[model samples]
Target: MGYLELALQKEKSLLCKRLGHKFKMASPIKTRKENRQVLYQCKICDQEAWLQWPEDSFNKLSENAEKSIA
Candidate 1:
């Protein structure tokens, strides 16, 4: 079960990267509640395109307009 979960997570991560490229959304960063932020490196661009940390943190790319373009 643990292995399956890990694989699923990996797949999801890859899918997100793909979605970002498809939508021209670059700089995938994750921010902590404590205000510390970490940038995500894109596999598509191995270098020179790290997503800004804590950038647009509240925005979501989902189909829900309330979240996508809020």
Candidate 2:
């Protein structure tokens, strides 16, 4: 889990413990930069969506910890 992932998971776990599967957050994938956009694609959910970052990030992607999104 990256910083974004960690925060998202924490929110999900807390939601589940409190609400019992009433909500969910989709997983997001960020792609390489091109032109001026950085792609963000979700890989964990059925409804796939793409997002764009304002600028390219120099930091490499890494996994922090495992936590269920739903």
Give a tens-digit lDDT track for model 2, residues 1-70: 2222211254333122222332232335344445433233233332222333344232232121113223
RMSD (Cα, Å) of model 2: 11.3
* Residue lDDT tens for model 1, 1-70: 2211111243334223333431122343333434433334335544222233343543332223345445
Query: Whole-model Cα lDDT per candidate?
Result: 0.32, 0.30
Clash count for each candidate, listed in order shown: 1, 3
TM-score of each: 0.21, 0.25
Worst ten-residue run, lDDT, model 2? 60-69
The C-alpha stretches of model 1 lying farther than 4 A from their native spots are 1-34, 45-70
